[model samples]
Target chain A: MTTSIRLPKELKVRVSEAAGHAGISSHHFILQAIEEKTLKEELNTNFYEEAEKRYTQIIETGECVSWEEMRCYLESLQSVPNPIKPIARKLEFNVKN
Target chain B: MTTSIRLPKELKVRVSEAAGHAGISSHHFILQAIEEKTLKEELNTNFYEEAEKRYTQIIETGECVSWEEMRCYLESLQSVPNPIKPIARKLEFNVKN
Candidate 1:
């Protein structure tokens, strides 16, 4: 499929240069970039939807577990001798402000 | 930071319904979904760029190898005698049309 995309002359120049550096045609480079981006977005959307569905099931059924407990359990599953087991962690809280 | 997003009434209704089913506020649900999509897109873009860069390097350095050879190498690495090793394969040719 062929499509027309309008871009600023500078941006077009940059893309052409990059495509040349990559030893590929400008069209192929753009197509590949777009394909990568679209695929990523789609995968992420599906993952989030699945996660939300599971979370909803747990919440409505009163089967929810605290993030702290979940983290501790995961940590315990790792080798005890590994010091890297308890690395920097960022926790997400579901509490409403 | 918060930004207002305009959506059609029907789309809004769908989002609201989904939020209610997920047992979360529409705002939170939308935020989570957007986050998931953005993350996925970013990761995919990076992956594709890296692959393209490597491919370009191979092309420019005259170190190109057939996709068949690479697939065979990967298949050999798998625990063989397993029929699953040689599953359906899609070959990508760099030849320009």
Candidate 2:
């Protein structure tokens, strides 16, 4: 698709300076820059999506490693060459019923 | 000034996905992304320009600290509380007469 974007006066000057530095035309520089930002934003979106999925799963399943178990695993890193892996257990919430 | 850019089929789709994630219209997202990239590129150009200027000055002035002095200062970092600072001396090129 083809579309027009309005560039401010100062932004136009900056683009020209940047484009000259990179030995490319202002239009080419803008295109490349937009492509880069699009890819970066896509990666960020994917990261947050994955994180949200994991968080929802944790909430529903209540399957997570306890802080004590995690601490033990971390502390064993130096003393114990082969530390036992921490296992995820169902979380228990104390509800006042 | 307004200019039209033709986006490839795949890139257009990617842009839409990214724009959706950002909760913004594709045009707005493109504009924002382009501005971010332009600013980043301008900074990079400025950095290189500064480095180039410094390098040109170093060559023209021939004022630079010797590597040996630099190494001595680095080595003294642990032992000496106030290590003598390395002074810049006019670099002498051992050119054959």
Which candidate ranks first by lDDT, i.e. highest?
2
lDDT tens digits by residue: candidate 1, A1-97 = 2233444465456556666666776556555554443445456667998999987876666555566666886787675653433433334557998
CA lDDT of A76 in candidate 1?
71
For model 2, how does the per-residue alpha-carbon lDDT over A1-97 read when each residue is reduced to its tens digit?
6767777778778778878887998888878877987899878988998999978988898898878889989999989999999987797866798
Candidate 2's C-alpha runs over 4 A off are: A65-97, B62-97
Worst 10 residues of 1 chain A by lDDT: A82-91
lDDT of 2 at A64: 84
Using alpha carbons, what is the TM-score of model 2?
0.62
Best model number under DockQ: 2
Docking class of 2: acceptable
| Recovery fraction of native interface contacts for candidate 1 | 0.00
Clashing residue pairs in candidate 2 are none
**DockQ of candidate 2 against the true complex:** 0.44
